[model samples]
Target: PPDVEQLGRATWTFLHTAAAYYPERPTPNQRANMLNLLHSLPTLYPCSHCASHLGDNLKEHPPDVSGKAALSHWLCQRHNDVNERLGKERFDCTKTDERWKDGPSD
Candidate 1:
């Protein structure tokens, strides 16, 4: 069984990568599916505290599934919020593409 931190990292990676590949102009069904996938996380995530916090965040700032860029930016902001709550340094949202989609230039 994965620990909470490991699970969180895996979940975020999956979400960010998925968002990175999401269509620029998704069909209505595609949009609905993506929305469902995201909205289900808070209820289905194994960690109770994480789930509750995500649920509250979702209520405060609903998912923006309009397109890939919008979704990625939204998720980055959400991740930054979680980082702040955990007393971690906030990530630069501007570098989300390099971090998630494109490998950073070494």
Candidate 2:
């Protein structure tokens, strides 16, 4: 079984990558589906404490399902908030595409 930290990292990676590839102008159905996925996480995530915190954050900020860029930025901001709470270094949101979609320049 994965630890809480491992689970968290994996979950974030999946979400960010998905957002990175989401359509720039998604259909109404697509947007609704994405919103459902995001909203369900707080209830579905395994870690109780993490789920509670995520639920609170979602209530405060909600998910930005306007488009790919908006969703990516929203997720990045939420990730950074979690990183701050954990005393971890926050990622640079500007480079989200590079980090998630494009390979880093060598």
Candidate 3:
């Protein structure tokens, strides 16, 4: 079984990548599905402590699924919140596409 940190990193990678590929203007169904996925995390996530924290955060700042940019920024902010709690450096939300979609410019 993977540790909490490993699980978290993998989860974030999946989320960011998904957000990167998300349609610029998704259909109502796509938005609803995205909301469902985000809402399910607190209940389905393996790490109880992490899930609780995420649930609390979600209550304070719900997911923004209006569009690809909105969702990507929302997820980046959420990830930054976790990074702050863990004393990790915050990722630059501006570079989200580069990080998650296009390869970083060398």
What is the C-alpha lDDT profile of model 1 across 45-93, one tens digit per residue? 9998999999999999999999999999999999999999999999988
Off by over 4 Å in 3: 104-106
> For residues 1-106, could you state the per-residue lDDT of candidate 3 as single tens digits?
4599889888998999999999999999999999999999999999998999999999999999999999999999999999999999999999999899998622
**lDDT tens digits by residue: candidate 2, 10-55:** 8988999999999999999999999999999989999989999999
Best by TM-score: 3
lDDT winner, 1 or 2: 2
| Candidate 2 weakest lDDT stretch, 10 residues | 97-106
The 0-to-1 C-alpha lDDT of every candidate, in the order given, reads 0.92, 0.93, 0.94
Which residue pairs come into collision in candidate 3? none
Candidate 2, position 28, lDDT: 99
Model 3 TM-score is 0.95
RMSD of each: 1.8, 1.9, 1.9
Ranking by lDDT: 3, 2, 1
